[model samples]
Target: MVKVRLWGSLRQAAEGQTEVEVEARTFKELLDRLVETYPGLAPQIARGVSLSLDGVIYREAWFTEIRPESEVVLMPYMTGG
Candidate 1:
Protein backbone atom coordinates (compact mmCIF):
# COMPACT_ATOMS: atom_id res chain seq x y z
CA MET A 1 0.00 0.00 0.00
CA VAL A 2 1.17 3.49 -0.84
CA LYS A 3 0.61 6.16 1.78
CA VAL A 4 -0.56 9.44 0.32
CA ARG A 5 -0.82 12.71 2.17
CA LEU A 6 -3.88 14.79 1.38
CA TRP A 7 -3.05 18.42 0.79
CA GLY A 8 -5.21 21.49 1.32
CA SER A 9 -8.78 20.85 0.19
CA LEU A 10 -8.24 17.22 -0.59
CA ARG A 11 -8.34 16.32 3.11
CA GLN A 12 -12.00 17.19 3.33
CA ALA A 13 -12.84 14.96 0.40
CA ALA A 14 -10.85 12.19 1.97
CA GLU A 15 -13.07 12.16 5.04
CA GLY A 16 -10.88 14.64 6.89
CA GLN A 17 -7.97 12.28 6.90
CA THR A 18 -4.59 13.83 6.40
CA GLU A 19 -3.15 10.57 5.18
CA VAL A 20 -4.49 7.47 3.41
CA GLU A 21 -3.15 4.21 2.19
CA VAL A 22 -4.00 2.39 -1.04
CA GLU A 23 -2.55 -0.43 -3.01
CA ALA A 24 -0.92 1.04 -6.08
CA ARG A 25 2.20 0.49 -8.14
CA THR A 26 1.61 3.39 -10.46
CA PHE A 27 0.07 6.86 -10.45
CA LYS A 28 -3.20 5.83 -12.12
CA GLU A 29 -3.78 3.03 -9.70
CA LEU A 30 -3.41 5.43 -6.78
CA LEU A 31 -6.19 7.66 -8.08
CA ASP A 32 -8.42 4.67 -8.79
CA ARG A 33 -7.95 3.29 -5.31
CA LEU A 34 -8.62 6.66 -3.69
CA VAL A 35 -11.96 7.11 -5.41
CA GLU A 36 -12.92 3.54 -4.67
CA THR A 37 -12.23 4.06 -0.99
CA TYR A 38 -13.52 7.60 -0.69
CA PRO A 39 -16.56 8.24 -2.84
CA GLY A 40 -16.64 11.89 -1.80
CA LEU A 41 -13.48 12.50 -3.79
CA ALA A 42 -14.98 11.29 -7.07
CA PRO A 43 -15.97 14.62 -8.55
CA GLN A 44 -12.71 16.36 -7.88
CA ILE A 45 -10.79 13.38 -9.19
CA ALA A 46 -12.88 13.32 -12.33
CA ARG A 47 -12.26 17.01 -12.81
CA GLY A 48 -8.57 16.43 -12.14
CA VAL A 49 -6.08 15.94 -9.31
CA SER A 50 -2.32 15.75 -9.08
CA LEU A 51 0.07 13.45 -7.25
CA SER A 52 3.47 14.29 -5.91
CA LEU A 53 5.93 11.45 -5.86
CA ASP A 54 8.88 12.23 -3.67
CA GLY A 55 8.99 15.93 -4.57
CA VAL A 56 7.80 16.12 -8.17
CA ILE A 57 4.17 16.83 -8.91
CA TYR A 58 2.48 14.93 -11.69
CA ARG A 59 -0.60 15.70 -13.71
CA GLU A 60 -2.13 13.18 -16.12
CA ALA A 61 0.81 10.87 -15.75
CA TRP A 62 -1.05 7.60 -15.70
CA PHE A 63 1.97 5.38 -16.13
CA THR A 64 4.32 6.96 -13.65
CA GLU A 65 5.75 4.33 -11.32
CA ILE A 66 5.31 4.89 -7.58
CA ARG A 67 7.37 3.24 -4.93
CA PRO A 68 5.62 2.07 -1.81
CA GLU A 69 7.87 4.23 0.34
CA SER A 70 7.79 7.27 -1.87
CA GLU A 71 6.67 10.53 -0.37
CA VAL A 72 3.30 10.95 -1.99
CA VAL A 73 0.92 13.86 -1.78
CA LEU A 74 -2.51 14.24 -3.38
CA MET A 75 -3.82 17.66 -4.16
CA PRO A 76 -6.04 19.64 -6.52
CA TYR A 77 -4.81 19.94 -10.09
CA MET A 78 -2.41 22.82 -10.46
CA THR A 79 -3.05 25.40 -13.16
CA GLY A 80 -1.03 28.28 -14.60
CA GLY A 81 -1.63 30.88 -17.26
Candidate 2:
Protein backbone atom coordinates (compact mmCIF):
# COMPACT_ATOMS: atom_id res chain seq x y z
CA MET A 1 0.00 0.00 0.00
CA VAL A 2 1.17 3.49 -0.87
CA LYS A 3 0.50 6.32 1.55
CA VAL A 4 -0.88 9.56 0.13
CA ARG A 5 -1.10 12.94 1.82
CA LEU A 6 -4.29 14.87 1.18
CA TRP A 7 -4.48 18.61 0.58
CA GLY A 8 -7.27 21.21 0.53
CA SER A 9 -10.70 19.76 -0.28
CA LEU A 10 -9.25 16.34 -0.76
CA ARG A 11 -9.01 15.95 2.97
CA GLN A 12 -12.71 16.68 3.33
CA ALA A 13 -13.64 14.07 0.76
CA ALA A 14 -11.36 11.58 2.49
CA GLU A 15 -13.25 11.66 5.75
CA GLY A 16 -11.10 14.47 7.10
CA GLN A 17 -7.98 12.41 6.66
CA THR A 18 -4.68 14.13 6.09
CA GLU A 19 -3.15 10.89 4.90
CA VAL A 20 -4.49 7.65 3.46
CA GLU A 21 -3.20 4.45 1.94
CA VAL A 22 -4.10 2.52 -1.23
CA GLU A 23 -2.79 -0.30 -3.35
CA ALA A 24 -1.32 1.15 -6.50
CA ARG A 25 1.72 0.76 -8.72
CA THR A 26 1.08 3.68 -11.00
CA PHE A 27 -0.69 7.04 -11.04
CA LYS A 28 -3.75 5.65 -12.83
CA GLU A 29 -4.10 2.81 -10.39
CA LEU A 30 -3.68 5.19 -7.49
CA LEU A 31 -6.53 7.41 -8.58
CA ASP A 32 -8.70 4.41 -9.38
CA ARG A 33 -8.09 2.91 -5.97
CA LEU A 34 -8.81 6.24 -4.28
CA VAL A 35 -12.24 6.54 -5.90
CA GLU A 36 -12.96 2.90 -5.19
CA THR A 37 -12.03 3.29 -1.56
CA TYR A 38 -13.57 6.71 -1.06
CA PRO A 39 -16.59 7.29 -3.24
CA GLY A 40 -16.72 10.91 -2.10
CA LEU A 41 -13.42 11.57 -3.84
CA ALA A 42 -14.80 10.55 -7.24
CA PRO A 43 -16.09 13.87 -8.43
CA GLN A 44 -12.97 15.82 -7.57
CA ILE A 45 -10.74 13.17 -9.09
CA ALA A 46 -12.75 13.22 -12.30
CA ARG A 47 -12.43 16.96 -12.55
CA GLY A 48 -8.68 16.57 -12.15
CA VAL A 49 -6.00 16.71 -9.45
CA SER A 50 -2.29 17.24 -9.22
CA LEU A 51 0.11 14.69 -7.83
CA SER A 52 3.34 15.24 -5.98
CA LEU A 53 5.65 12.27 -6.08
CA ASP A 54 8.77 12.67 -4.02
CA GLY A 55 8.74 16.45 -4.40
CA VAL A 56 7.89 16.57 -8.10
CA ILE A 57 4.42 17.77 -9.02
CA TYR A 58 2.70 16.25 -12.02
CA ARG A 59 -0.56 16.76 -13.86
CA GLU A 60 -2.37 14.08 -15.88
CA ALA A 61 0.53 11.74 -15.57
CA TRP A 62 -1.42 8.51 -15.49
CA PHE A 63 1.39 6.04 -16.02
CA THR A 64 3.95 7.55 -13.69
CA GLU A 65 5.47 4.84 -11.54
CA ILE A 66 5.22 5.27 -7.79
CA ARG A 67 7.59 3.73 -5.34
CA PRO A 68 6.42 2.38 -2.01
CA GLU A 69 8.76 4.66 -0.15
CA SER A 70 8.14 7.75 -2.25
CA GLU A 71 6.31 10.67 -0.74
CA VAL A 72 2.94 11.19 -2.38
CA VAL A 73 0.51 14.06 -2.12
CA LEU A 74 -2.77 14.97 -3.84
CA MET A 75 -4.05 18.47 -4.38
CA PRO A 76 -6.32 20.40 -6.71
CA TYR A 77 -5.04 20.87 -10.21
CA MET A 78 -3.40 24.20 -10.92
CA THR A 79 -3.80 26.30 -14.05
CA GLY A 80 -2.13 29.51 -15.15
CA GLY A 81 -2.67 31.88 -18.04
Candidate 3:
Protein backbone atom coordinates (compact mmCIF):
# COMPACT_ATOMS: atom_id res chain seq x y z
CA MET A 1 0.00 0.00 0.00
CA VAL A 2 1.17 3.49 -0.81
CA LYS A 3 1.05 6.23 1.78
CA VAL A 4 -1.11 9.14 0.68
CA ARG A 5 -1.32 12.45 2.50
CA LEU A 6 -4.33 14.67 2.02
CA TRP A 7 -4.56 18.40 2.45
CA GLY A 8 -7.12 21.24 2.49
CA SER A 9 -10.61 20.28 1.37
CA LEU A 10 -9.46 16.86 0.39
CA ARG A 11 -8.84 16.11 4.01
CA GLN A 12 -12.24 17.42 4.97
CA ALA A 13 -13.85 15.43 2.19
CA ALA A 14 -12.09 12.32 3.42
CA GLU A 15 -13.69 12.64 6.83
CA GLY A 16 -10.82 14.64 8.30
CA GLN A 17 -8.32 11.93 7.63
CA THR A 18 -4.84 13.27 7.07
CA GLU A 19 -3.47 10.16 5.51
CA VAL A 20 -4.56 6.93 3.88
CA GLU A 21 -3.13 3.74 2.48
CA VAL A 22 -4.01 2.55 -0.96
CA GLU A 23 -3.01 -0.22 -3.32
CA ALA A 24 -1.96 1.06 -6.69
CA ARG A 25 0.82 0.60 -9.25
CA THR A 26 0.39 3.89 -11.01
CA PHE A 27 -0.78 7.42 -10.34
CA LYS A 28 -4.01 6.90 -12.28
CA GLU A 29 -4.77 3.79 -10.29
CA LEU A 30 -4.12 5.68 -7.09
CA LEU A 31 -6.64 8.38 -7.98
CA ASP A 32 -9.17 5.75 -9.04
CA ARG A 33 -8.78 3.89 -5.78
CA LEU A 34 -9.04 7.04 -3.71
CA VAL A 35 -12.30 8.07 -5.39
CA GLU A 36 -13.59 4.51 -5.09
CA THR A 37 -12.82 4.36 -1.41
CA TYR A 38 -14.12 7.85 -0.76
CA PRO A 39 -16.80 8.73 -3.24
CA GLY A 40 -17.05 12.26 -1.90
CA LEU A 41 -13.59 13.01 -3.23
CA ALA A 42 -14.62 12.35 -6.83
CA PRO A 43 -15.72 15.86 -7.63
CA GLN A 44 -12.66 17.57 -6.17
CA ILE A 45 -10.33 15.07 -7.69
CA ALA A 46 -11.97 15.47 -11.08
CA ARG A 47 -11.78 19.22 -10.91
CA GLY A 48 -8.02 19.00 -10.39
CA VAL A 49 -5.47 18.15 -7.74
CA SER A 50 -1.73 18.07 -7.39
CA LEU A 51 0.08 14.88 -6.58
CA SER A 52 3.43 14.55 -4.90
CA LEU A 53 5.29 11.32 -5.50
CA ASP A 54 8.44 10.74 -3.53
CA GLY A 55 8.85 14.49 -3.12
CA VAL A 56 8.17 15.32 -6.78
CA ILE A 57 4.96 17.14 -7.65
CA TYR A 58 2.86 16.41 -10.71
CA ARG A 59 -0.28 18.05 -11.96
CA GLU A 60 -1.44 15.51 -14.55
CA ALA A 61 1.13 12.81 -14.93
CA TRP A 62 -1.19 9.88 -14.51
CA PHE A 63 1.25 7.38 -15.97
CA THR A 64 3.73 7.99 -13.16
CA GLU A 65 4.63 4.70 -11.55
CA ILE A 66 3.85 4.27 -7.88
CA ARG A 67 5.48 1.66 -5.77
CA PRO A 68 3.96 0.04 -2.72
CA GLU A 69 6.13 2.16 -0.47
CA SER A 70 5.92 5.42 -2.37
CA GLU A 71 5.35 8.61 -0.42
CA VAL A 72 2.39 10.35 -1.99
CA VAL A 73 0.64 13.60 -1.17
CA LEU A 74 -2.65 14.73 -2.74
CA MET A 75 -3.85 18.29 -2.49
CA PRO A 76 -6.04 20.80 -4.23
CA TYR A 77 -4.47 22.79 -7.03
CA MET A 78 -3.10 26.23 -6.16
CA THR A 79 -3.21 29.29 -8.36
CA GLY A 80 -1.67 32.72 -7.90
CA GLY A 81 -2.28 35.93 -9.72
Candidate 4:
Protein backbone atom coordinates (compact mmCIF):
# COMPACT_ATOMS: atom_id res chain seq x y z
CA MET A 1 0.00 0.00 0.00
CA VAL A 2 1.17 3.52 -0.80
CA LYS A 3 0.57 6.40 1.56
CA VAL A 4 -0.56 9.52 -0.26
CA ARG A 5 -0.59 12.85 1.51
CA LEU A 6 -2.27 15.95 0.18
CA TRP A 7 -1.74 19.63 0.83
CA GLY A 8 -3.56 22.96 0.25
CA SER A 9 -6.54 22.68 -2.03
CA LEU A 10 -5.97 19.03 -2.56
CA ARG A 11 -6.57 18.42 1.09
CA GLN A 12 -9.98 20.00 0.79
CA ALA A 13 -10.88 17.60 -1.95
CA ALA A 14 -9.99 14.73 0.33
CA GLU A 15 -12.42 16.06 2.92
CA GLY A 16 -9.63 17.63 4.97
CA GLN A 17 -7.95 14.28 5.26
CA THR A 18 -4.20 14.52 5.14
CA GLU A 19 -3.44 11.04 3.93
CA VAL A 20 -4.73 8.27 1.72
CA GLU A 21 -3.76 4.75 0.70
CA VAL A 22 -3.50 3.43 -2.84
CA GLU A 23 -2.78 0.08 -4.40
CA ALA A 24 0.02 1.10 -6.71
CA ARG A 25 3.45 -0.17 -7.48
CA THR A 26 5.02 3.05 -8.68
CA PHE A 27 4.61 6.80 -8.46
CA LYS A 28 2.69 7.04 -11.71
CA GLU A 29 0.52 4.16 -10.66
CA LEU A 30 -0.11 5.85 -7.36
CA LEU A 31 -1.03 9.04 -9.22
CA ASP A 32 -3.37 7.16 -11.47
CA ARG A 33 -5.11 5.70 -8.45
CA LEU A 34 -5.38 9.12 -6.89
CA VAL A 35 -7.04 10.54 -9.97
CA GLU A 36 -9.34 7.58 -10.09
CA THR A 37 -10.29 7.69 -6.42
CA TYR A 38 -10.56 11.45 -6.21
CA PRO A 39 -12.08 12.74 -9.38
CA GLY A 40 -12.18 16.25 -7.96
CA LEU A 41 -8.43 16.27 -7.56
CA ALA A 42 -7.76 15.37 -11.18
CA PRO A 43 -7.72 18.94 -12.39
CA GLN A 44 -5.23 20.08 -9.79
CA ILE A 45 -2.92 17.19 -10.54
CA ALA A 46 -3.19 17.85 -14.27
CA ARG A 47 -2.18 21.45 -13.72
CA GLY A 48 1.24 20.17 -12.62
CA VAL A 49 2.22 19.11 -9.13
CA SER A 50 5.38 18.17 -7.27
CA LEU A 51 5.64 14.93 -5.36
CA SER A 52 7.80 13.89 -2.44
CA LEU A 53 8.51 10.41 -1.24
CA ASP A 54 9.35 9.73 2.39
CA GLY A 55 10.30 13.42 2.90
CA VAL A 56 12.65 13.80 -0.07
CA ILE A 57 11.49 15.31 -3.32
CA TYR A 58 11.33 12.83 -6.21
CA ARG A 59 12.96 14.59 -9.17
CA GLU A 60 13.53 11.74 -11.57
CA ALA A 61 11.16 9.36 -13.24
CA TRP A 62 13.26 6.60 -11.72
CA PHE A 63 11.45 7.16 -8.49
CA THR A 64 8.42 5.80 -10.24
CA GLU A 65 10.13 2.49 -10.92
CA ILE A 66 10.61 1.17 -7.42
CA ARG A 67 7.74 -0.41 -5.59
CA PRO A 68 8.02 0.51 -1.93
CA GLU A 69 5.62 1.21 0.89
CA SER A 70 6.10 4.91 0.17
CA GLU A 71 4.97 8.07 1.77
CA VAL A 72 3.91 10.24 -1.17
CA VAL A 73 3.21 13.91 -0.62
CA LEU A 74 1.76 16.25 -3.20
CA MET A 75 2.09 19.98 -3.54
CA PRO A 76 2.19 22.67 -6.17
CA TYR A 77 5.27 23.04 -8.32
CA MET A 78 7.60 25.87 -7.39
CA THR A 79 8.60 28.49 -9.89
CA GLY A 80 11.16 31.27 -9.63
CA GLY A 81 10.36 34.46 -11.43
List clash counts for every candidate, in order.
Answer: 0, 0, 0, 0
- Name the better of 2 and 4 by TM-score: 2
Off by over 4 Å in 1: none
lDDT of 3 by residue, 4-80 (tens): 99988999888889999988988899999999999899999999999988999999898999888778899999889
**On residues 5-59, what C-alpha lDDT tens digit does candidate 2 reach at each position?**
9999999999999999999999999999999999999999999999999999999
Candidate with best TM-score: 2
Alpha-carbon error at 8 in model 3, in Å? 1.2
Q: What are the TM-scores, per candidate, against the unseen true structure?
A: 0.94, 0.95, 0.94, 0.79
Q: Is candidate 2 or candidate 3 better by TM-score?
A: 2
Better of 2 and 3 by lDDT: 2
- Per-residue lDDT of 68 in model 3: 81
- lDDT (Cα, tens digit) per residue for candidate 1, span 8-75: 88899988999999999998989899999999999999999998889998899999999988999999
RMSD of each: 1.0, 0.9, 0.8, 2.2
lDDT of 1: 0.92
Question: Over all chains combined, what TM-score does candidate 3 have?
Answer: 0.94
Name the candidate that leads on lDDT. 2
- Model 4 error, position 5 (Å): 1.3
Candidate 2 backbone collisions, by pair? none
Residue 60 of model 2, lDDT score: 92
TM-score of 2: 0.95
lDDT (Cα, 0-100) at 3 in candidate 4? 73
The CA lDDT at 80 in model 1 is 97
Error of 3 at 38 (Å): 0.3
lDDT of 4: 0.74
Ordered by TM-score, highest first, the candidates read: 2, 3, 1, 4
| lDDT (0 to 1) per candidate | 0.92, 0.96, 0.91, 0.74
